[model samples]
Target chain A: MEKVDCIIVGGGLAGLSAAYGLASEGLEVMVVERGDYSGAKNVTGGRLYLSPIRDIYPELWESAPFERPVTRELVTLMGDGASTTIELASDRFATAPHQSYTVLRARLDQWLADQVMEKGGMVITKNRVDEILMEGDKVIGIRAGGDDIGADVTIIAEGVLGLLSSKVGLREQPTARDHALGYKEILELPSSVIQDRWHLNEGEGAAHLFMGEVTKGMMGGGFLYTNKDSISLGIVVGMEAMRERTEKVESHTLLDAFKELPHIRPLVEGGTLVEYSAHAIPEGGIAKVPKLFGDGYLMVGDAAGLALNALLTVRGMDFAIASGFYAARAVADAKNRGDCSAAGLAQYEQSLRSSFVLKDLETAKEIPHIMENPRLFTHYPQAVSGLLEKLYTIGPHPSQKLSSTVIGGVRKDFMNARTLKELLAMRKI
Target chain B: MDIVVSVKTNLDLQMIRIKNREPVLEAIPYKTGDLDKNAVEAALQLRDAVGESKVIVLTVAESNRKVRETIKEVLAMGADEAVLIVDPALESTDQAGVARTLAAALQKIGSYDLVLFGEGSSDDYSGQVGPRVAELLGVPQIGYARQITAGGAGVLVERSMDEYIETLEAPLPAVLTVVSEINEPRIPSLMNIMKAGKKPTEEWSLADLGLDPAAVASSCETLSNLAEEQDRKHIMLEGGAAEQAAGLVNALLKEGIVGR
Candidate 1:
């Protein structure tokens, strides 16, 4: 049997971050990944908010492979044939330690795994960890390929599926309501074209999110993040709603409709589809988070359901990094005390409760429920677009007061007191 | 019996990106050649059958980060040890140069009873390395072996030659190239992967093997490498299902791709 100070069961951001932290402190750690490499199996909407992870690896962006610093943010509400957009751009976003950057997980995760190895950690790829070895209810190691390897501590950082965590009873199997299916395509274009289309300067990028009919009234949205020489565009739809969708409304059909939208087509015109991928996202928020730590074991990243979908910004990678960092700290503390028990490992949850990871999720816990309302996906965006159109159209004989036009549009949608209250609640997030 | 398997780290063709009709090869990720892994599996199988043998993996490539990762993968696949010849001068080495460098490393080790090579590399299908190495080492060589069995102090191999299969025997101390159908490679377990890091991997250069770089210079030179731009006529056949079917059949028949 082989022994290590720590065994990490996935090489995603969370696992690699924990491995990096443990290895940097002179702990022997091994990260076993089932993919050909760390990021080989990961997919994301392509923008990573780096503020939360700046402290994890202070110099991360200095050496990491980032597509571009995002200087522009655009959010659009799409109606049947029209849309309303809010665009924000700032020069401050282009500086070092910038707000966020666009990245392809395949390159970023591999770079992080390399960093872990360079920090004296070991990473083994193309190997699946079949099961966690236990000693009287304590996770002692992992069994992979019919071989038993022992470790002082084990961390499961598997992504949204959380297969290992569920198998080990850390959490129940996620249902359709708790997960979302995201399909993304990487479109190849010239760097100059991306800059021109997104109104970005050299080395600057944009993140654009689309709500409303882009999802074909499904409870989901479309996203586009600018890479250096390509565009990452995709749609994310809730599985609960997707399951109830008629067979004629397939997920790819939704993506195809989104691509043909008047506001989205010109941006991706003449681009080659280089790659397409689909992945599951854990959208269950803090309410669905499982028990984070146990005897000789810890769960981080999506395995712990540590993702937040705040409508304007959907984030997981940052949360994964933060959780990984906190989990490693707790594990290191436990090791220093020579206690690898459930009581000792409980500090991880404590750290998370006090940290931004859980706090942010707690604050946005209601966003998922609010987003689940079908009218929010179908009625609200169209009403808003109708109100804007009434305000903008300059017909010769119909010059009504702006307030009356707005009131008329709202009344047209049958926005009564209850609907107004619901809209207010939805806006609170 | 001791066996040495020669593997090559080639660019993952699937991951290759074509830009402006040119392949962006510099930063593309590389993996151990797919069929070369079969050769490694064959060598490991021979060792398993012989009961007391070692599988030494050998590769000649530039000493870079990508090559190091590739070498680790080969080691994890059950190679007892590895000999890596990573030198800047060999970055563009041709088949002949690679064969010479490998032959020199084998000669330096000096005790291998058999050597294994893939019939051809995935990136460059020049199936000359094994035979050229044998010629340089002055050893008998067998090419395109689909199945191999160990006999007394020797091995017998089954090979396909054009339209016929032939069985041949080679005494100890010979070279053999294997086809992809030889055997399925095994994925290393987590424990074995951990142990692979501790396995002895010795790095050598051309000078370390007491060979002059000038004598092993590449003979073949690549003039131009470009992605083949395929001009596809994406003509959409329209109308009802039966009409479209008849139109497709008519098109194929016009192109002589279907029955008359």
Candidate 2:
């Protein structure tokens, strides 16, 4: 049997990050993937945030198989028939050391996996690791395909829904409490139409977030992002929240509701859906993260419950990449010291904590509960939309001032004191 | 010269829908398991290569009777015989135990030049039964086969691996588990369906095989419940076509994909 310094169990962003980092240091690594290839099973919200990548892969945008760069961001507060949207554009994002770029996980991860192989790491696709091989409570290797592959250390980068972390007694069996399921569709549109619609130059893009009746009053939000000549559109809902609501809902039913929303309809009017998919995310925030270090093993990315700052918008890929980078660094350090024990691997957890991954996760832990309040997700968007409708409409009747329209909308949904509290509470969280 | 291909009716995953939080697999239509697809394809291919008189279809799920109707459909594809291995006690057996009962029937059939199976069943995905059956029958086995070609006193097969492929030859009467890409299965013609009715079908009961139900019953895995993951919700983007395009681009950027 060929022995390796490290074995990674997944081929997502985190796994690839670790692989790239370890291989760059000249360590023998193997990535066991369950997909047809690196990205066959990966689904993302369609962005690659740049802050994390600037230090590791500064010039990756030109070399990477990215779709486009986004220079605009839109937050839409929508109701049944009207919406108030805030669009923010930054010319500063247009230059290199770019702000953010859109990437297809399939293309990006495949490229990253190739780079790892290019650096002499072995990537084995179509193999599912069934169990972690242990020696007296220490993870020594992995068992897959009725064959055992021995390694000095193992990094469990398995995706969020994988049960292997719990199987080896490292993490508790996941519950609906800490997770949400997201369903996405990739629609194909002409590149010219995309640029014309989004008002972008050849390579620029924009992203939008929607609230209120689009979800039909559920506790989740919708998103749409532009690609080269296609769009990534989807909805993500809290699992526990959905369970509490007494509604018979299916993803397709919710999809139809989103499509028929007056504020959402024309955006995707003539596009053709090319791919439809469903995936789950760890939404339990910082509190639900499992044991990050154990006997000769470690978990990172979604498996470790390191998702993103939830209320700021769904962000996981960047966190996944950053976590993977740190995990690989730890493995490299442990190798340098010639110790692959749990104590040696604990460096990974420490470094991750000291890094932005943990600091941000810890701070944003309370955001989910704050966002869980239905009034914030519903009445806030409804109130904004109602106010906008009154301000924009030109009617034959006596016109009301914009201030009166805002006050009237707030009074319809909340009393003056309650409106102030809601705004303040939202700002504080 | 008769061939027996074992098949089971399983839940059609494509049509299965969850209503009231219960997976209605039974309510959904049934389809032949992946193994049976390869078995039928193998039988049809052999029938064309050797002669039609020697090909047969064998299944262990005859008690359902609906299963027999399915077997007829297989015969319609080209099998010269249709046999059903039916026994009330055989229901709900695990992979290892199912292999045991199958080994018993294969032994009673006496001898054959070859026996083929798909790499594994779809539901269990155990990928164990073929090798386990070969062990029981005292025959050499080759698995993960992407291509098979007849050879002297044995067969030559190409085993597909993750990156590399290997080809090996095993003696005649050996067992082989084939892969999906081996061949495109054929559909039964109208004439073949009419002819299948006249074909021979050997129906076997548990008593005929001299099997004790008590021995096999103990090996079955217990089933308590079946559940499915809940579906997600929809969050549509806003601001007409231009806004929608801008929204997508912005999401990608927020995801940290675009600029720096």
Candidate 3:
């Protein structure tokens, strides 16, 4: 078997980030990806919070093929008959150093791979890593197709499934209850039209989320993000919630139904459907995160379960990139110390623990349990929208005083003991 | 023995999209053309059979854009070396200019037992470069070669034709254009991909080829390359399921698609 300094099991953002980091420091690294290209098989609801990883690769982002800087945030609490959208625009978010940007993984990953190549790294696509090769459980390297290529350290960033790691017993098998399936469509609209529809200032973008009936209260939500000349509209549903439902629904049909909503219809009108993709997202939070480092291997990205979905601020890509950056730094340090053992590579996990990658996941530790309550996805959106609807309704009959109307709706919805219990639990979040 | 394969890089047509009856070329990745890969495979197999042979990939930059990565893809397929003929004058060059530049590079290499090429490029199926370069190099050429065999001083090739297969023998250092039937191109192993970038590659400009840039400049212009507008036949059959099935069969028979 031929050996290199490091082998990355996937050519996603995480693996490429690690490769870029290592190659810039003149290390021999190769990334194996199963997709025809770097991101040919990945999908995202797809916005990157750049602030978390702004300093990881400061040189790469300015010229990166980011679709648009996200400046506006909208969250729509949707009900069966009504919906309410709250839009927030901040000067800081719209400033030169924008906090986040909407992304299409195919474009972003390919461009990042190019940067990796520029720094002298090999991103071998169309090759699936079949096994994480083990020499007495030291994680020597990986076996792909017919080749067993050894490395001082192996980095597993094979997205959410973690098939290779799971098969080797390095990680636990993913469960339906711990994951969510996200389906997305890249719908193209004219650039001017996109700006006009999203109320953006030319290149600025918007990130919107819809809850409640969008997912039939299935502990999920619908998201719409504005791209340069397109919009990514998608729906996410908890796999367990989906499986337990009496009315079995195909994921695509959910997106279709969401799009048919009166509130959503006008937003996607006249848009050309360009791409459709569905992927499983790791929503297990920190509790389901597997072992980060062992022997000669380090797990990053979704393979390590380093994804956080804190409702309105769903995230994964930033954590993936950040973990990769830290992995590279740790690997470089390990090599410098003349040891590739578990003890030497311990810095990988330690760095992630200290960085925003793990810290944010820790802060959102109770999200998975909190999200399972179902009412967050169903009753709350309806309650909020229904109350607002009452407050704003006017007719031939004389309406009640505004204070009375507000108190009545509040008493009817929020005054219950269960509601109080739920509100009391909110402090954990 | 030493073999040189001329690979023409083209945009991955599968990734291209037709928008408003026009091909959107933005962000479409360039790759070693489809049949061009078959040419590389043939060259690799021949190099292995001939023993102690070198396979060098030769390419003329179709445009001034970066082709190093595209050429490296050929090297990953076991080409020992790469020679890229890149010049500002060749940016929009037509078939003749590319053939001339390829011949010039072959002359510079000046050491090979055989030269191979795809019958035609994936993007532009002109099928003229191999024969044209052979003419410019004053070498015997064979086209549409499906099977090639190495001999003492030359080679025997089985060429696929419209109605029948014809066998032809060409002397050493001849040019052969192969079809997709030749062989399947190997997906380079991880090691090969890792080493591809380190392979020896040379970049030659028009000056290096001893040709004046103005003389080798593109002699052709692409007026308009728009996608062909296809009109779907709006055929509707007003019938029940059984009648619709019978109607579909009858329509297919009328079109000679289901009849014996």
Candidate 4:
């Protein structure tokens, strides 16, 4: 039997990160993946928060196949035939370190996996781990294809469907309610066209978030992210909400509603669909984190339920990278001591709790409940869209000020007393 | 020439979540383990190289139901007959134990031209089994084979190593672990999926193999507790794009992916 310092499961962002970290420490590590390639089965909104990746792969931007750095952000409120947007643009993020960037997961994951292999780590792809090989209560190795591959420590970076995580007792049974499903389509558009339409520079990108009628009163949001030559557009809906309303609606209907939104139509007009992908995300927030470490093992990234504080933002990729870093640290420390056990690996949990991942998830736990209010997904966006439409439209009669129009629209959608209560509740939540 | 392809299923990590001090997982409805993609692909390639009529797909798992379904999919993708070892007691067996079980089954089946498997599975990711099973069966095994070719009763395979690749020539009935760097796996066609349903999936129980549970090695190592969490912080960039870009670049430099 061959023994390694550590074995990491899953070859996506988290597992690759752990492998990279462990290999950098001169420890022998092996990473196993079930996919044809690291990102073959992965699907995401396509935007990566730049901070965590920058911290782990500092000069990666120089040669990495990044789509583009985000230079503009748009928040839109949608109505039947009208929409209002809050646009923010700053020329600040164009240099070395970026605020955020976009990438196709398939390509980025493959590159990151290469980095792990380049650092003297072993990468075994298209392998599925069958079971955990144990010595008493301790995990000593993993079983695949009827053979045991021993390791001092095992880090599970398997993405959302962490089957082994639960089997190993790091996680329990996850219900659909604690998760969310997202379906996306990538639209091919020329660079110049994207630059002209989204008002971006040669290598810049834009991100747009849609709320209200797009989800059709469901508890979710829609997003559009510009890539090098394409746009990633998708909608994420709460699994529980989807289940609750399943009999009455279908995803295609919701998709059609989203596509029919006036502002969305023009943005995607004439674009050709190049790819379609769907994936499930763990949105259970901080309260949902499973056991992060146990005897001889640690969990990182989506396997540990690392998501951003708010569903509106891009978070998982950065969190996955960061957690993978910590898992590697814990394993390295354990390897130095020649020990891989529950107690020896406890530092992985401690380090993770101390990182920005747990804190963000904990903070964002309230956002979901706040978003549960019907008005947030229904009345509020409609009210804002109507007010914007009134502002932009010409009138022949004596003018009504923007303030009055906004007040009138707000009143039409919500009573003053109720609106005040909702605002207060939103603040408290 | 019949072929045996080993496949194993793993937890779908995409639906996995850490909740209430536990890692929660949901059972996958139906999908072969990712590595099996390579095995099926390799078999189809060999079949295409030789003849589809000669290739066979096989798997050994505690649960033959899923294995049978998976084999059918493999057949649809291009394989022939399939063999499944359906022993309930082997469900939680370790790698060595599984290897022994599969070897015993292979011995009973006898006369396989080639044996193929994925480098490792995604969930547990143990890369030892193919070689171990080969050891048990006393056959030459090739690890991390990115490309394989059958010629003159021997197989030519490109074995991918940490930093280099080696082309190895092995005799017939060799065990090969496929790497993702190999050819892309072909998706099963609609007609193939339908035809896979008709492929013969031979089921064998421990009783069929005349094996005793006590005879096999058993190591019950259980993973029961894991505690780690992620903390996310959104530091809204204070300055405009240029400032944020500089800060981002500095952060990247700290991470060490780029040169100063």
Candidate 5:
């Protein structure tokens, strides 16, 4: 039996980040990835918030492969035939030490894996870990491709699916009820064109989100992020919403439809499609977050249900990188104490709870449930766009007074108790 | 018998993106030439067959951290050791320059009963390095080897040619380039990969081989390299299926493509 000080499964941001920290501590670490390389199998939708993770492994982020620092934020409320867009171009967001930067997982993960290698970490790719080697309810190691290897601690960062972890009873099997399906197309556009379309300076990025009619009143929306020379345009739809629809809709059709919308068409016109990817995202929030650590094992990244969708911004990568950082520190601490039992490794959960990873998740805990109501995706966008369209339009007849129109529109849409109650209910979150 | 397998690592061609008809080569991961992996497998099998044998992997590429990282793929695949001949000068070196460098590295590595190479690198496919190295080393070279076996005082090799397969026996200390049909390369196990870092590796430069850099520089300059642009003649035939079928047949007959 071969053994290492640590075996990190799945060479993703989580696993690679852990390996980077552990190797810096002179610990023997190995990362087993199923893809040809670390980022080959990863999908992000698709920006990383740097502020949350700037302090942890700050040196690595300095030279990280960031596409562009997002400066402009746009959210469109799509109605039947009219859509209203709110654009926020803040000076602070565009300044030095930006908050978030768009990232391509394939480039980002591979670069992080390279850094891990530089730190004397072994990242093994193109091999799937078939089983988590267990001994009497304790995960001791992993068996991958007929290679049985042991380790003092096994960090299961196997990502969103977590098939092996679930098969071993470490986590619950993912259901359509607790997940979302994201489909993205990387459309190549010249840097000048991206800047012109999104109205940006050189190397500045924009994040455009569309709600309401985009997801067909479903509990999901459309997102577009500008990259260095490409724009990642994608749509996310709740899996349960998709499965429960009376009309069968192929996921790709939704993307094609989105590209054809009058507002979206010109934005993507003449753009060549480079890569199309679809992935399942964990949408369970903190409630579904599994036990972080237990005898000889710890689960980080999506495997532990650590993703959050705050409507304004979708976050998972930062939580993943941060969780991996904490996992490494906990494992190193446990190894130094010469005890890897559940009790010894319990610091992982406590540290994450204190870190921004869990705190942010806890702050947004009710978002997943609140977003489950389809009216937020449907009624709100329609009401807002409809009211604004009426206020701006001049019909064939005489128009009403601005004050009367405002009151009428408000009384029509905002007077209902259900709507008010919904609004007040959201204040807690 | 000590065996040496020479490999060339190229940017993963599949991941290369074409921009403005030119390849976007930045950030592409480097990979061993597909057929060169077959050569490594052949050497490994031969080493195991002949007791008290060892296999040493060799390459001549850019002397960078990425190249060193790329070489680990072969090292993890059961190779006993590796000798990397890398220098900044080899970046633009041509096939002939590569042959000169590998021949010199082979000489520096001393005794070997067999040396192996792929018929051509996966990237260039110039099919010149193996024969050139064999000529420079003054060893009998047999290429396109599909089967090789150690027998008596020599080895028997079955070579696939344009017309037929030829079987011949070559004495000890020969160079053979195996075709991809030789054997399947084994995926390195997790344990082997973990231990690959400990395997003794030697790095050298043209300076170490006592060769001048400019003497082996590329002789020819490439004027341009662009992806072939293909235009589709998207002709649409309007009508019912039967009419459209007839129109399609007529178009093909007019173009002499089919329906003659």
Candidate 6:
């Protein structure tokens, strides 16, 4: 039987990070990935907030494959035919250990896995782990293709689906209500065109988010992040809300509708579509965080529901990296004490709680519930656009007072005491 | 019995992007040709049928990191070992040059009862390498074998021809090319992928195979390889649903795309 000190299932950021940490510390580690390469199956919004990862590998920013630094942020609220946008660009976002950078996971994860291998870790791709090998309620190894490979401890970072995690009873099967389905397209354009379209300097990019009519009143929104020479555009909708939708709208139909919007069409005009991908995001927040440790096992990343959907910004990769970092530290401590039991692995939860991961999740735990409010998707955006139209439209006719016109439009559509109350409640989170 | 399977690393055509009416081939992902996977599967199946056999995978390409990665994929697919012939001089080699390099590699391997290849590669569907290699090696060649079976001291192949299928018998030490319909390629399990890393893979240059670069130089030169831009009529039919459907039918009839 082939044996290793640790076995990591899934080769995304979380699994690769743990493997790199353990291997760098002179531990035997192997990562088994199901994709042709590390990030072939990974999809994200997607941007990596570099602070958490920089804390783990300080020199990574110099050599890591990053698309562009996001120096501009834009958020748009779309009504039936109009949009109100807020754009922010600052030099403060471009400094060292910068805010965030857009990443193509297919490139970033592969480079990370290569880093793990360069550190003397083993990474096997294009192979799926069938089951977690267990001996009397403790994970001992992994079984794939009628062969058993032993390990002292196994870490499951199998993304949102968490197939192996659930099979090993470390997590519950995620339901549609707890997840959001996302579809993305990578559109190819010249770098100069992208720069001109988004008003970006040499190596700077923009991250844009859209809500309201983009989702057609569904509980989700759209995102567009500029890569080096391509634009990643997609829509993410709540699965429960999608299931409740009266119209049988396909996800691609939503994306196409979004592309046809006057505000979005020009940004992507003349760009050739290069790739389309779809994935599910864990949206249940901390409420859905699964059991973090078991006998001879631990869970991290989306497998443990570490994604945060704060409406304006959705973050998973950063939390994934942070959790992987802390999980490795806990596992290393357990190894030093010569104990690989559930009690020994309890330090992982403690570390996560003391770190920003669980703290941030706990603070914003109500954001997901607030995002489920239908008025945020339907009424408020239309009212805002209507108020803007009333204020801006001028003709030969007599004009009413601006305040009265705005109040009349808001009262007619969505702005009322009840909605104001809900908005205030959402802000408290 | 022993078998030599010829594989080619070609740009994934599905992932190719066009820019300025030209294929943007730089940094495009490379993989074993889609049909070449069927050839490898056929070789592995034959190895199993022969009771005891070794499958040797061979590829001739410009030596680079991508070629090495592509070789590991086939090795993981169950090839016992592999021979990679990479040289900068072979960068622009044509089908004839590829056939010569493969023939020389087969000669260097000393002995093999059979040779296998895909009917055509994805990048250049020239369908010439297998027959050319057979001619160079002076062996009987079978093309487009849809089904193969082992027999006493020989093999029976069901050849797929344009008009009709023909059954042909070839003795040991012959070459055969297979179509995608032959068999489904197996995805290597995790254990197989792990073991593939430990498998013996040897790198050989033209000099290692006792072949002079000048002798096997490519004769055919490519003049132009450009992306074909498709032109479409941007006609809009403005009316109600039924009227728009009628308008589309009329337009199709005017273009002779549909019969009345």
* Ranking 2 against 5 by TM-score, winner: 5
Which has the better lDDT: candidate 1, or candidate 4? 1
Name the lDDT value of residue A159 in candidate 6: 89
Q: Which window of 10 residues has the lowest lDDT sum in candidate 2 chain B?
A: B188-197
What's the CA error at residue B101 for candidate 3, in Å?
1.1
lDDT of 4 by residue, B196-224 (tens): 65577688887788877654546866767
Interface RMSD per candidate: 2.0, 20.4, 0.9, 14.8, 0.9, 2.9
Q: What is the interface RMSD of candidate 4, in Å?
A: 14.8
Candidate 3 - chain A - TM: 0.98
Q: What TM-score number comes out for model 6?
A: 0.80
Candidate 1 has an fnat equal to 0.83
In the range A1-429, model 5's lDDT, one tens digit per residue, is 889999999999998888999999999999999898889999998799999899999888889999999999999988778888999999999998999999999999999998998999999888899999889889999998877899999999999988999998998889998999998999999999999998899999999898888888888899999999899999999999999889888888889999999889999999999899999999999999988889999999998888999888899999999899999999999999999999889999999999888998999988988998888988889999999988999999999999999999989898889899899989978
Model 2 per-residue lDDT tens digits across residues B77-113:
7766766778887775666666777778787877666
Give, for candidate 6 chain A, the lowest lDDT window spanning 10 residues: A52-61
The top-ranked prediction according to DockQ is 5
DockQ score of each predicted structure, in the order shown? 0.57, 0.01, 0.74, 0.02, 0.83, 0.26
Q: Clashes in model 1: which pairs?
A: none
- Candidate 2 lDDT score relative to the true structure: 0.76
Candidate 2 residues A190-249, lDDT tens each? 898888888888888888877776676777778889999789888877777788878757
Return the candidate ranking by lDDT, descending.
Answer: 5, 3, 1, 6, 4, 2
Model 5 lDDT, full chain set: 0.91
What lDDT score belongs to each candidate, Candidate 1 first?
Answer: 0.88, 0.76, 0.90, 0.78, 0.91, 0.86
lDDT of 3 by residue, B1-260 (tens): 89999988888888989999889888887777888899999989988988899999998874434676677788988899999888777776788888888888899999988899999999889999999999999999999999999984599999999899999998988999999988988888889888999999888888898987766666777788888888865778877999999988988888789886
Instruction: Tell me the lDDT of candidate 3.
Output: 0.90
lDDT by residue (tens digit), candidate 6, A1-429:
787788898899999888888888877787988887789899988688886567677756689999999999999888888778889888798666587999999889988987887776778876788998778888888987677888778998888998876876767987999999998999998899999999998888899999899999899999999999899999999999989988878888999988988778999999888789999999998999988888898898998999888887788998888887777787788899999999988999998898878998999989888988888988877878777977999989999988889778877775668877896897769
User: Rank order by DockQ, top first?
Assistant: 5, 3, 1, 6, 4, 2
Give candidate 6's error at residue A115 in angstroms. 4.8
Give Cα distance to truth, residue A30, candidate 6, Å. Answer: 5.3
Candidate 4 residue B151 C-alpha distance from true site, Å: 17
Give me the overall lDDT of model 6. Answer: 0.86
Badly placed stretches (over 4 Å) of model 4 are A59-61, A134-137, A309-311, A391-403, A410-417, B1-260
